[model samples]
Each structure stands twice: as C-alpha cells, then as structure tokens.
Target: MYRIAFGTSGWRGILCEDFTFENVKVVTQAIADHVTAIGERDKGLIVAYDTRFMGERFAKETARVLAGSGIKAYFCKRDTPTPVVSFEILRRGAAGAINFTASHNPPEYNGIKFSPSWGGPALPETTGDIERRANEMLGEVCYRELALDEAARSGLLEEIDPRRTYLAELEKKVDFAAIAGLGTVAVNALYGTGRGYLDEPLTAHKVSVRTMNMHRDPYFGGFPPEPSEKYIQDFINLVKGDPAIRLGIATDGDADRFGIIDEDGTFIEPNYIIALLLDYLVRVRKMTGAVARSVATSHLVDAVARKHGIEVIETPVGFKYIGELISQDRIIIGGEESAGLTIKGHVPEKDGILACFLVAEMVAREGMSVKRLLERLYGEVGTFVTKRENITLSPELEAGYAAKQHQAPGEFAGLKVRETVTVDGSKFILEDGSWLLFRKSGTEPVVRLYGEASSAERLAAVMAAGKAFILG
Candidate 1:
C-alpha cells in the first residue's frame, strides 16, 4: 500500500504509481470514515470526476467503496469541473464532496480534492482527519457494496446534474447579458471542461464567439494541460489573427483556474487579473468590503485598496487562507497568485469560469479593451513586472531554501534590498519598489523564484540572479 500524502489542497499522484484503483478505494473509504466520524455517514456523500482518463471510473469505484461502507455516495454521472462538484455538496446539504481531478497538473497525473458541505475546499483540520483515516486504510476497505438499483431503493445513492445546477447558480454572479452583447470573443478550452458553459452564455445571448479545442481529448493531445504560457499559444494566436476578437480566456485541466490574453494577445498574469477585477467590482459595482490576497500576489492590489480607503489582508500562499477569510469576514473579493478567486456571498471556492465571464463583461460594459483596462490599473497602482522561474537545487541548498535561507547582498542588479520578510517564504523588497521571492514547490523538487520588478530589464536580471543561485 502506497502512502497518500495530502498537499495544501488535496491528494494527488501519478495515475499508475501512488494513484491506483486500490489506492482510490482506500482513500474513498477513508473519506467515508471521516464523514462517519462526524456523524454524517448515513446522511450521505457526493462524488464527481473530470474528463481525464479513468476519472469517471475512479469516481464510480469510490462510490462503490463508500456505499459498501454504508455511507451513501451521490455520484455525478457526467464529466464535470471541480467547482461544480463543490457546489453540489452545498446545494444538496451532503456531508461533503470528493472530486477526481488533478486540477492544473499534467495529464498523466490525477488527484482527489475533498470539499466540505459549504461548497468550499476542505480546511487543514478536516483534511488531517481524512489523511489519518487514509493512512490506516491499508487497502482494507471495509464496506458492503449495494447494487445501484438497490442503493437507490434503500434511499441512498443518486446521480447528479452538475452542469444544470452550476449554470443556474451562475446567473446571479455573471453578467451574461452584457457578455453576450460583446460582438466577437475568442475562447480556447485547451480541450478542458471550460468549453460548454463559456460558449453557452455567449450563444444564448446572441454574442458572436469563435472557439477552438472544443472536442474532448483525455491526454489533452500531448500538451501539459496546464493552460500556462507555452500551453496556450494556440488560443493567443487565434485572438491575434482575428481583428474582431477582443479577449482570450483559457482554463486549466479540471477548469478551476484561468489564464487570460488581452486584445494585444499578451497573457495577463493572474495577480493582475484579480486586482483588475477587484478594481472594476468595487469602483463600478459599488461593492463595499476589504480585499484578501495571498502574500505571493502582487501589491498592486494593495495600492488600489489603499486608494479606495479599504483594508488589505495578506495570507499565506494558498487559496484556503483567502477562502477562510471570505467565509468569516465581509470580504468583497479574495484572490491568489494562481488564477483562483471568489467574491462576496458567492461560493467560497474559486470559480475560474465565473471570473472569465466577469472579465469579458467588465470590458464590454465599459467599452474598453482588456489591455486598456490593465494599462489604466497600472497608471493608478504603479507598474509591476512579474516573472517566475524554477530550477533544481542541490540537496543542501534545498533544505536551506525550504527553511527560507537568506543571503544578504548590498545590491542586486543595481537595486538595494530595502527590507526582507518571510511570512511563508523568503521575500526581498528592493528599493525600486520591486520584490523577489524564493520558495519551494510543494509537489516537485524545483525551487521556484519569483520577482516583481519596476522594469523589464530589472525583472530579467532578478530572474538571472535567482536562477544562478538555485542552479549553482
């Protein structure tokens, strides 16, 4: 039996390695035990899977184990995104949801994310319980399988329609009418599940939109399925080649995170996307509340919030922190450096599909291009050049960076280190209003270096210096 380790969000591993049918059964039973421990075992559970290889089959296997354990599992019958499952957990008032997806990981990998009944990602405390139960499972899933017809007759299992409920709930958050009015928009699913909903709103409202990669491919057709810069050039080129196309939106595998392209066909960083939307929502929509952002996110948001006389709260480098704040506080918006975001009174989980629609509506309603909107935001919040690079470190250096080792240099690239902070990792604040961060990727052996510079050259220089330190 392979030990299943949980990341900040969920449990993930390569499909054939740590992730297997036997292991999935073990984890799902553990999840059943977790729900049972909370006195909700017979109250029921929900299961959903994405379009990846064997995701649906994995979801069924999990249900089989859970049902066998006497914990009824509400299985999602169709391929769907992670957020849709999270929403179902809350809407149905079930114990929680277990999703079969790897999020933005490569196609070869798969993962399981446990969402609480509130339709939000599980907290560390709760996930700890599930992990403890998983470790003790040891491939011995003690549960009795009930036939599907028998289970339904016993008032237990039911298949769900994630798309129908998800679409209905979205009307309250997205300006579907305004987005549909935008004449021509280019969207590339990157063959991810983001295709169906995005094209629907536009088509329903008579908006002229062109699409690509709409067909499903389990392998993602040899691409990494991350929707990162290199993986999304096809969509960028589509937007650039067509003069009528205004914005380009792409979602990662499982469709929880989004990557964007402006009218100029340049990928807009997620940090900027969050800040830009925050600016639009608060300034135009008259929403009132504080802003929550991860520590790794750009301070341009802080600048905007300061101008608006609102407080800014910074948390560790995960959406859980932001989501926790949103659940407890009257937060107008919460965002992370990655493309996950949530708004006030909406589902606490991040919704990339919602964000994509809102961004297009923001542009259409104001009669401004995404590039122009970002430029205006820069003018108000000051310029920011964000760059990230990763490299493998020697074992010794790995430990140091993992512990946030600091090297005091008088100046780096003609800019002095003004101050240093280590909230979650090492972050150096430069005198020129730029910063550099060195942090270890939780799931990989590489050390990631991020820098926000005041100029393009300074950004490049910081990257070079960081690469040299990490690779050397």
Candidate 2:
C-alpha cells in the first residue's frame, strides 16, 4: 500500500492510483481524529477544492466524512482557491481547513492541504500525527460518510462561496484605484480556480482587463495549470503580440502562486518579483516591518531590506514558517522563491490574487514596466542572478546524498565557502556573496539545486560546481 504522506505543502498522489475515494476517506478521517484530539473540532473546519478533475465530488465526499464524524463542515459551494480557504478559516474563527488541491502539480495529481486554527498550512508535527493516523487506517474502514442531504438536515453542513468576501478583503489590502489607471492588464488563469478570483476583482474596480483560460477544463488546456514560464507560453505570446497590454499576470491551479510577465513579454522570475515587491511595499507604501524569505530565495530581498533599514528573517523552504511570522505580525511580507507569498494583515497563506493586484498597483503608480522597475532596483541595490534546477540522481548517488550534504565543502568553483546554512537544506554561502543550496525533494526522487550570484556567469559557475559536487 502506498503511504499517505504530507510533504511541504500537502499529501498528493496520482488521482486513481493512490488518491482514490477510499484513500481520501482515510486521510479525512485521520484529519478528523487529529482535530478532535486537539479539542478544536467544536469550532468546525472548512472543506474546499480547486478546479481539478472530480473536485466537487471530492469536496462533497470530504464534507460528508466530516459530518459523519459528528463535526461541522463549512463546505465551499464551488471550487475555491487555497488562500481563500485560509481566509474563510480565519474569517469564521473555525478550527481549520481541508483544501483539496495539488497547487501547481500536473492534472493527474490531487492533494489534501490541511490548515490548523492559526490559518496557515499545518506544521510538520501536526502533519506527522495525521500521517501516522492515516497510515494506521489504510487497510481498515477508516471513515463514516453521511449523505449531503442528511448532513444539511442535521445542521452539520453549510455551503458557502468565499469569492465575494475574499475579494472584499483584497480590496482593503490592495490599491485597486491605482490599477484602474493602467491602460490594460492581461491575465491568464490557466484554466484553474483563479479564473474569477483573479479577473473578477479587476473588473469590479473598473480596470481594463483582458483575460484568457477563464473557463473550467479539467485537462487545463492540455498543460499543467501552473503559471510558470514553461507552462504559460500561450499567455506569453498573447502579451508579446499586444502593445496595449502593459502587464501580464497569471496564477497557478489554486491561486496561491503567482507568475508575472512584463510589457515586453519577459517572464519575471519569482525571486526577482519578491525582491521588487518587497522594495515597493517598503519605499512606496511606507509599510514598516521586518521581511521574511526562504533560504532558497534570492539575497536581493535582503539587499532591499538593508536599504530600507529593516531586518530580514530567513526561514526554511516552506510558506508555513513565513506564515507563522505573518500571523504574529512580525513581518511586513513573507515570500519564497517558488512563487508563494503573503503580506501582513492578510490571511497567513500565499495569496496570488493579492500579489498580482499589488504588482499592478505598483506598476501603475510607478509609471514603469516591470522590467524597468527591476532595472531601477538593480541599480539601487546590487544586481543578483538566481537559478534553480531539478536534477535526477542515479541510484548510487541517491543512496549517498544524505551523508554528502552533511560535509560542507571548503570551496566551490574556486570560491571559498564562507558559511553553511542548514535552514532547509545544505546551503554554502560563498565568499563573494553568492550561494548554492542542495535540497532533496520530499515527494520526488530528485534534488533541487539553487544558486545565486552577482552575475549570470557566476551563477552558472556556481550551479555547475554544485552539480559537480553532487555527482562526485
């Protein structure tokens, strides 16, 4: 039997092979047990899904399972974004949320993301308990399911649409008036739950918005519903062909990760976007607080923080750690290199809709394309180049990787290793301000090699040296 394990985000598996109805029940029951044990079951939980295959069916089944456990289920009426589910959990003061989404994963995959009462992704200890409970119940009849009608009759189920409330919340955090002044903004939802969540707010604010992939398609236009450069070529082409479109914004399957294209149709890296947004939020918005970023993220953010005289909090490679600081109002913004981000006074989860709108507002008010703004930032703070690669290891290398990671090298690509950081992985900070990180994927049999330097050539050299170190 396949073990039901929760990774950095959640527990994901192939739709029919491992993420079957029975497995979903087992996981849901495990979550129910965890909630009950924590004494939070009385407050109830939010059950939501993204626009994936059989999404609603899975959500309904989840709600039935919650109801059968004699726990209240605040069921979302339709497919909803991950951040919206987090918003609803805090808005209603509920126990937590069970979000059925695989985020940016491919079509054949689905996942269960559990958030506790703190309105962030569940921590490792909590997920570990749930995993232990789920594994124990794998072969047993783990869950009791109630009919939807019976669940409603017993006052255990309540259907909700979080769009309006979530949008209203964004309206408060983002300056829609500034974005409305822009000539045109192009958006691509990539045929996921972000369709209305990303576009509707713009329309309501009287912004001239052009959108694509707004319809529901389980196949996601034959590509994964990720908004990254490789997965969103059509949107890139559309923006490139149109001069009127000043900015292109896209959101992944669950609207928790953002992708940005400049007026020149250049896909801005998330590392740079985070740094630019951090600068904008502090300099223009006059927001004052420390900033948080994952260790894998570019040091450009740190440069910006130093320029603004704010401290930087470096965390492990998970939004949940950053979310913890956000929940406590300890940081003005928190982001990761993987396109996940959240701000203060918002849901303690990544909100791509908020990030997109904030970018629009910054562009409109600054009167510059994203590229120009990036260039300006580079001139002010020193330039930084970053890259990440997923490298598959041979069986022999895979077996020895754990031990190798512990032995920090003295030099890489001729640069002296100044320090080693083990926040999330083995990261060697070189003498010249460049860094390299090697992290094994929790869910896949691959290692993520991340490198950053002051120049592209240096970044390439650093990455090559990292690869060589792994291979040797």
Candidate 3:
C-alpha cells in the first residue's frame, strides 16, 4: 500500500521494507501502464539487477509484472550495472529500462532506476509522471504469473546480454591507446559494478594491470558501496604501500561514480578530476568544446575553463541536468562533486569505466603521475582541498534546520558570509574564500556538509562553523 517516491534517480528503499517483492510488482505495472498509455507498449521493457539482496528475484518479478500487463519485457541474464542495462535498452530500442540497483547506497538498501528510450536517465518530468502512475497503482498490483514456456512463446519475455553494447560504446568514446602507454597501473575496484568492465580495456592495452576486490559480494563488506574517500581508503593505502603503482581506480555500486587515488596514495576529489580532465581535453587533446558541472562542484573547473577561454556550464545538482546539457550540445565533459560524470557522444549516464580510462590516458599521455598531474594543474590554477561530512538527523529536525538556513547565516569564524546559494542547499561562501554547503542526503537519513578552502585549518574551521549551524 506504499506510494512510491522517486529519489535522485529512481525509487529506492530498504529491501524487505518499502522495497518488498509486492512493491516491485506494483512499480513494474505502473511502468507498463505508463508505456501503454503513451502508445509505446509494443516497444517493450528491459529489466536488470545488480548483486544486491534478492536482486535476481526482484528483476524477475518486475519482468513478470510487465509481461502480465501485456508489455514485452527482456530481463538481463545476470547481474549488471545500471549503465550497462541502460545501454541494452537503447541497443534494442526498448520502450524503457528498469534497473534494480540502489547505486552506491548502504547494503541494507535496494532500488530501481528507469531509463527512457533515449537511453538516458528518465528526465525529471517523465520521472514525475512515473511517480504519479506508481502511486496510483500502489497496493493494486495483483500480478498474474505466466509460465516460462508460455511467456517465451508469447514473445513478451526474453533474457538479454547487457555487456557487449556498453563495452562497444566505451571503445568508441575513450582513447584506449593513451591508457595503454602507462607502463604499470594498479586498479582496485571498490567492490562495485565496475569489476569486469575495467579488465578487458586494460588487458587490451598490454599494460601491467592489477585488480583487487572485484568480487560482487552483495553486502559490500558491511559498508556503503559509495566510492568516497573513506570507502576506498583501502586502495589509497594499497597505493601508498607500493610506489610503483602510479594510479588507482575505483567505482561505486552500479559503476556510475568514480574514485581516483593518486600515486602518493591520496584520494583526489572528483571536482579536481573534473577540472584536470577539462584542462587535458581542451588544452592538451585540442578537443574544442565546453565543460559542464553541477553547482556543488568545485570552482576550480570554472577557473581552468576561463583561463583556456572555454565555457563552463553549471547545473543545480543532478547529472540529469548535466546530461540534458550534453544532449543539447552544451558540454564536452560533465562531472559532479559526488563523482557522477559523462562526456560528449557517451551515454548520458555517469560511467566509472570511462572515467577511469580517461584519467589513465591523461597520465600516460602526460608521462606524469596523478599526484604530479594535480601539482601541475594546481600550479597553473591554484591549490585547493575539499572535505565532506555527513551528520544524521531526523527528518523533522532536518526540516526545521533547513528553514533557518534559507535566509542564510550572518557570520562564520569571524568572517562575514559574502554569498549564499540555495541551488542544492545553503552554501555560505565566506569572504575569506572558505565555503560550506549544507544539504540533506536524498538517499539516507543524513545531512551532508561540504567544505573547501586553500588550507586544511581553514577547511576544518569551515566544517566546524557549518556543523554548528546545522546542529543548532
């Protein structure tokens, strides 16, 4: 009887809770209903799931519900990334794609993300429509079971191989030869969906590629599968333990977010990666195009783009905005602070595999370590460090706190707040150039605080002042 609400990407919840088998069936029926109403029922639906709990069963239920509703459904044969399954939708020109992946959330969670026929994420307007349809069908799904033999004969159910199409797209967009030139690169995938995707590309490079933690254990080792600094600190330590491993690569669950550990074993932030890639693509590769990012992303990219006389487009927060910009021919590369990214001629979804190879290619072409590349990038622009912290608060308390931040803070750490932005959250930019942005996490019961400054001390101060505001 639970009405579904779409989060950042799609509907997600704790497995066996709001994400029960019953709810999935209802959601599938809603999707099928929407497609049928829009006159695309014959276009069919594609379904896939990750390695989360009961993911296979969830996908099967989704397909069964869709097929029961007289909508053709082609489900994935095995575990797959959201991006990979999304690729299959476009490859087969299906009506839509439904992927059972919570996408970097804690192991206790599982969810679905839908892709439209364009193969990009279902845009906000369409997602809103789906939500309406799903809520209407809530508790009304009494799915009819179709025998496998009958379903196959009806030509409404099939199993698909989801990898080949996405891999082919990767080969076209990424410069593989550049990455191959790196003599030795260590790849430690953060136990997410990027496991096999990284190997084939690197193996063809003939470079010494070493990988770890590729197993798709659904629990994610008792931690969230996010590719944040803390989540991938193991890879950071691994790189620090060995000087020969020049670059470390990782991906979040579902293989959309990317993590980069420098040669010095420092976890470089995604904002920095965005700026550096912008510089490399436009300045070095002579790729004449603009860069785009969410407003929460570092200003370093804006700084870099201005220096090169290129353009930088800023969105509110979601990759959907950035993806739309890419589709509209506004950007050549798009990345967010949270590590979601995409590029021109690529699927509108963030791709960890493509991001990994792009950075590796930059290192090989420049003949510099990620650490050194950052140094040079900083030398040209300026040095910056960013840190983020999450504070748990009840929804009621968070709503009250946000109401106060809407008008902005008067001061922080003896410096007057010169600017305030409510783009995604309340971002108080102090006159000293230190900044703090407080926003509620869309996926969890926590409020994320992001701070950036030129020094560690200032960054700490920013965090402290921001924490006081949030907790107060």
Candidate 4:
C-alpha cells in the first residue's frame, strides 16, 4: 500500500494509481475521525469539488464516508471553487470542509484538501494529525459508507448551492460600480469553475464581458488548467486583437490562482499584481495593517510597504502561513508570487475571483490601464524583475542536497552574498539587494530556482548563476 502523504497544499496523486476510490475512502474516514476527536461531529462538514475528471464522484464518496461516520455532510450540488468552499464553511459554521481538487495539476492527478472551521487551509499541526491517522488506516478496509439515498433520508446529507450567497457577500468586498464603468472586459475561465464565480458577476453588473473556455471541459482544452503566461496565449491574443477590451482575467482549475493580461496584451506577472494591489489597498482604499507575503515573492512588495510605513511579514512559500495571518486579522492583505491572495475581512483562503474584480475596480478608479498604473507604481517605489526556473535533479544530486553537504558559493553572478536565509530553502541575499532562492520540490525530484533583481538583464544573470551553482 502507498503511504498517504500530504504536501504544502494537500494530498495529491495520480488518479487510479495512488488516489483510488479505496484511498479516498480511507482519507475521508481519517478526516471524520479527526473531526470527531475535536468534538465537531455535530457541527457537520462541507463537501466540494472542482471540474476535474470524476470530481463529482470523489466528492460524493467523501460525503458517503462522512455520513457513514454519523457526521452531517453539507454537500455542494455542483462543482465549486475552493474559495467558495472556504466561504461556505464559515457561513454554515461547519466543523470543516473537504475539497476534491488537485488545483493546477495535470488532469491525470486528483487530490483532497481539508480546511478547518477557520475557513483556511489546514495548518501543519492539523494536517499532520490527519496524515498519521490516514497512513495507519491504509491497506485496511477501515471505512464505512452509506448510500446517497439512505444518507439523505437519515438527515446526514443535504445538497446545497452556495454560489449566490458567496457572490452576495462578495458584492460588499468588491467595488462592482467602479468595474461597471470600465467599458468592456474579457474573462478566460480556462474550463474551470470560474465561469459562474467570475464572469457571471460582471455580466450581472451590466459590464460587457467576452468569455473563452467558459464551459466545463475535463480536458481543459488539452493543457493543464493553470493561468500562466505560457498556457494563456489565446486569452492574451484576444485582448490584443480587440481594442474595446479593457482587461483580460483568467483563473485556474480551482479558481484560487489568477492570471492577468493588460490592455496592450502584456501578461502582467502575479508578483507585480500583488505589489500593485497592496499599494492600492493601503493608499487608495485607506486600509491599514501589516502586509503579508511569501518569501518567494518579489521584494517590490517590501519596497511598497516601506514607502507606506507599514510592517511586512515574510513567511515561507505556502499560502497557508499567509492565511494564518489573515485569519488573525493581522494583515491588510496576504499574497504569494504563485497568484494566491486573500484580504482581511475575507475568507482566509486565496480568492482569484476577488483579486480579478479588485483589479478591474483599480483600473476604473485610477482612470488608467493596468500597464499605466504599474508605471506609476514603479515611479514611486523603484523597479524590480523576478524570474523562476526548475531543474530536474539526478539521484546523486538529490542525495547531496538532502545531506546538506553541497554548499553554494559565497558570491554569484558578480554579487557578494550579504546574508543567507534558511527559512523554507537556501536564499542568498546579495549586496546589491538582489536575491536568489533554491528550494526542492516536495513531490518531485526537482529544485526550483527563484531570483529577483533591479532589471530583466540582471534577473537573467542571477538565474543563470543560480543554475550553474545547482548543477555543478
């Protein structure tokens, strides 16, 4: 039997391989046990899934396990976004939620994510307990499942659709009026659950919206359902060819990560978007609090916070750390370079739907395009460019890194390392204020190299030097 493991997000594995129906039942039973131990079985659990292959089947199976365990299951009637699940968990005062989604992973993969009653991703302590329980129950038929009809009859299962309620709450958080004045906008759901969560709201507000890949497609138009630059070329082309469109927005499979295209067809990186939103929230919206960002994010966020005289909390790469700060109401906004963010007063989970709509409002209120606003931001707080590359590691190299015997040089790309941070990985901060981070993937035999510098040319040099150091 495969030892069930959870990563920074959740437990993800290839379908029919490690993530089989039997494994899902085991994990669900473990979650049920955890919830019962906390005395929350009476409070019930929310169940949701994305638009992946057999997503509904997995979610129903999870509900069956919960029902058989004598826990109420507030099951979603359709595929839902991750943030929506988080919101529903808080709204219903449920014990927690189980989401069947691999996020942006390829179609062949599927996984389960558990969010606590606090409406954020489960932290290490919580996930560790669940993981231990799951592995112990593996290879044994330690689960009991009830039929859907029997579960419903016994009041252990109730179907629900939380979209309208979620969108109603969002009306207060986003300035739809400002977006309505911004002429036409384009949305690319990337064949995910973003259609009703993102584009529908704009259309309801009478904003002219052009949508692509809005319908559900398990294949995701033949690529992974990630809203990155390389995968969203069609959306970029649509924005560039159409002179009437003001902005182009896209979301990943779970609608938790975002991709943006400027009016001129330029793909604005998520690092810059996070910094821009932080600046806007502090200066324009008058929100006050510390800003939270992942260590892998750009230093430009630090520059903005410094300019505004606000504190900056830098956490490791996972959004859950940032979400912890959000849950405590300690930060005005928490974001990561991977296009995940959630603000204070919102569910303590990444909401790409909110992020996109807020950007539309930003453009409307500023009376400028996203590109122009970015220029204004650069004018205020210098300029920085960031890049990331992945390197596959050989067995020997992986062993060397795991042993901590292979150390990086004191200088790289002609810059002396001023300091090193071993928070999540090995980060070398250079004298020139540039930085490079080398971190290993938790699920794969690869290392990710992230760099940020004052210019694109300098960023390239830093990345090249980082590659050489890792390979050699």
Better of 1 and 4 by lDDT: 4
lDDT of 4 at 314: 85
Candidate 2 wrong stretches, greater than 4 Å: none
Instruction: Show where candidate 3 strays beyond 4 Å.
Output: 142-145, 394-399, 442-445
User: What TM-score, over all chains together, does every model reach?
Assistant: 0.94, 0.99, 0.93, 0.99
Candidate 4 residues lying further than 4 Å off, grouped into runs, are 403-406
Give RMSD to native, each candidate.
Answer: 2.0, 1.0, 2.2, 1.0
* Model 4 lDDT per residue over 370-468, tens place: 989988989998999999899999998887886652467888899999999887888999999999999999878899999999999998999999998
Per-residue lDDT, model 1, residue 331, is 89
In lDDT terms, how accurate is model 1? Answer: 0.80
For each candidate, the alpha-carbon lDDT, in order, equals: 0.80, 0.92, 0.80, 0.92
The digit string of per-residue lDDT tens for model 3 on 1-472 reads 5579987788889887898888887777777777878898898888888878888888887777776778888878878777677567767888978899998889999998888887777788888888887787776645556655667789988888778777877888777887776666777655667777887778876877778778878889778888778777777788889877878888887888888887788888898999888888887778777888876788788878888998877677777778777667667799999888877767777888788889988888898877788889788878778888889886777668757766556888778989887778778888977788887876567888888887888888878888887777
CA lDDT of 133 in candidate 1? 82
Look at candidate 1 and tell me the lDDT of residue 410. Answer: 54
Pick out the ten consecutive residues of candidate 3 with the lowest summed lDDT.
140-149
Query: How far is 452's C-alpha from truth in model 1 (Å)?
Result: 0.5
